[model samples]
Target: MKHARPLPAYMVTRYHGWKATTHAENKGWYRRLADEGQRPRAMIISCCDSRVHVTSIFGADQGEFFIHRNIANLVPPFQPDGSQHGTSAAVEYAVTALKVSHLVVLGHSSCGGVAGCYDMCSGNAPELEETGSFVGRWMDILRPGYDMLPEGDDEARTRALEKVSVTVSLNNLMTFPFVQKAVEEGTLSLHGLWNDIGEGTLEGYDPDVDAFVAI
Candidate 1:
């Protein structure tokens, strides 16, 4: 079966408009960065959710943020195995190479990947067999959190699990040797953020208070 051409006229027109605007807005920054290289102050690890766009949310322009995105905005424990570690690679580059002072793990409400973890933990649904390849492996990172949650109603349990999962991912960030050393040497700091979609509120992790406070 022949597939239809993906790029339609409307998409092409929109892309052109975006390209023009982006170029005009970021022209100076691009020139300066191209000459001197990017030295972004922070690195943001966020989810690959269309609604939770880091640039748009933070009002960041080009070369402003070193971003690393993946499913559920998860940061996996560092491993030495020579495998494809996209998130880890980005972290290493951002911290060691770019020397970003702050690393923020940005989580949001109504996250599909987090919702998937809720489904897996509850056992209401079987292991996804159709697209059971990468998603299954990716969702495994949330298993420890899932197991830790107490049995209860789906809504309450899922909400609790999602919040706890943010903490879990934050803990996992320290497992990386680079991140650990950076934090120990006071070169880099880690922060966790939870964005409420409905309320347009941002809650940031307070290490001193050991809680997420609205910002």
Candidate 2:
């Protein structure tokens, strides 16, 4: 019946280290943030992959960005069926509540979620095709992207889908009525990005050019 346990040794040690240094140095700023509440200007939808460090990549300061992470950094189309949807809830809060000026969907290279989706669409990942598979169902958001993928080897196809995931999310974001209204009123903007983890390269989707240009 117990739902919690003591912190791991490594985590405890790291917490102490941070408390002694980072927390100590930012004690005043932390207090101010707590008292005033967060007013971040942007919302970032990113992958759950550990390698994709959203704040570090942008050199962002604490409380500067509102971030939500999920499989493949996907945004599902608006569905008001009254079921629980964590990703959708985050988007709703960020756009309608937080009123973030910019919303970004950030994907990355070598994403396991994207790879799984690729294989699933290709009929290579039978396990993921099961109806009870949460991952398979979640990845259905990227199914359209898979269908649009250009012909290529597995390596190239996987990489391309990574970016396609971002585009798909960006498109889906617009499906939300609030998001569409905010964008139409010129109060919000949508962006798609793909991060090349190993190469340390960042690309932003350019609708004008229909490509991801290095940024």
Candidate 3:
């Protein structure tokens, strides 16, 4: 049997200190938000990568954005599968319940999940014995983008595939019923963002230019 472990003393101390600071700086704002009700202006769909934190990247304060994180930040098309729909549920809540004005898909460079998809596409990885393993199934979401990439060096190919997957995921987001309806009504706007980790640069999708331009 596994036993639950308490948080490390250092971490506990750090957390309490951070909480005190937060409360000191934002107590009034928190009260107002609670009283008036939270109405975040945006929802961010982001990867579970520790290096690609959405709040820090966007300089968002607490209650400023509704956030959802998942493997590779993929948003599956809406379907009634009687299965858990983590990302989709967040989208539904953000659009339907929160009614956020903006929904942004945030992608980052050197994503391991995206790299795994590229490896699966190149047939370099061992074949999956089961069709339903978590990583295998999640990689399926990026299969179309993988199919679109040209065969080449593994590293370069993976990066390119990751970039393409962002575009694919953006398309997938539009296919969601709630997202489609919101966009059609013009109550919500969709944006795609790419963050280059090494370069510390951020880029936004420019539909008019058909490219990602540095922001």
Candidate 4:
């Protein structure tokens, strides 16, 4: 194997800082966790946006939540064609192997992926519609959500679709047989969440009201 370049100075300094502080403070807790295998109770599907800090928002410690971040936090319908599917694979592992009690589909406001889908479908982003675009194909998972959004100002439409994307993923998660079985048997619960990054507020999808309510 080829030798890789060294890490940046700032990254190395950050590691040393963490080792001296957080890691030092949590050494015993970390050691216990390493001795015992992780048994996380929840699986969080969230966007890959750097602004969305999953652990920070939940105040979660290590081994508390199994998180999978992808573009738009989108999950496609269950497809068992013996092909590569990263999101589905994670869902399968979390449901079947991890036996997580909760599966949360987390979306956030001002999502670039959601906005790209809106633009692609609304004839504003021609480049995204190209056949070879990976992001375009990925954003297709949220197309159904975009179609269901009510017409409004650009900002309103974007925010609405962002929340819709969470619903779409939650709906699609049921298409997976294992997920459906777990949910039916009361072994797993599904949740839809939308975060306002700027406001630092969270809204949860209420099935009865058919809207996101502050939690």
What is the TM-score of candidate 1? Answer: 0.88
Write model 3 residue lDDT over 47-140, tens digit each, in one string: 8999998888778887899999888878887676899988888889899999999999888899988988877766766563147668878878
Residue ranges of candidate 2 with Cα displaced over 4 Å:
none
TM-score of each: 0.88, 0.98, 0.91, 0.97
Local distance difference test scores for all models: 0.83, 0.95, 0.84, 0.95
Lowest lDDT 10-residue stretch of candidate 2? 1-10
Sort every candidate by TM-score, greatest first.
2, 4, 3, 1
Query: Which candidate number maximizes TM-score?
Result: 2
Judged by lDDT against the true structure, how good is candidate 4?
Answer: 0.95
lDDT of 1 by residue, 126-213 (tens): 6632365477678778778887776788776676666666778889889988889999999998888988877878998787987778
For model 1, the local distance difference test gives: 0.83
Which window of ten consecutive residues has the lowest lDDT sum in model 1? 124-133
Q: How many residue pairs clash (N, CA or C atoms closer than 3 angstroms) in each of the candidate models, in the order given?
A: 0, 0, 0, 0
What ranges in model 3 sit over 4 Å off? Answer: 127-129
lDDT of 2 by residue, 13-50 (tens): 99999999999999999999999999999999999999
Q: Extract clashing residue pairs from model 3.
A: none
Off by over 4 Å in 4: 1-3
In model 2, state the lDDT of residue 211.
94
The lDDT, on a scale of 0 to 1, for candidate 2 is: 0.95
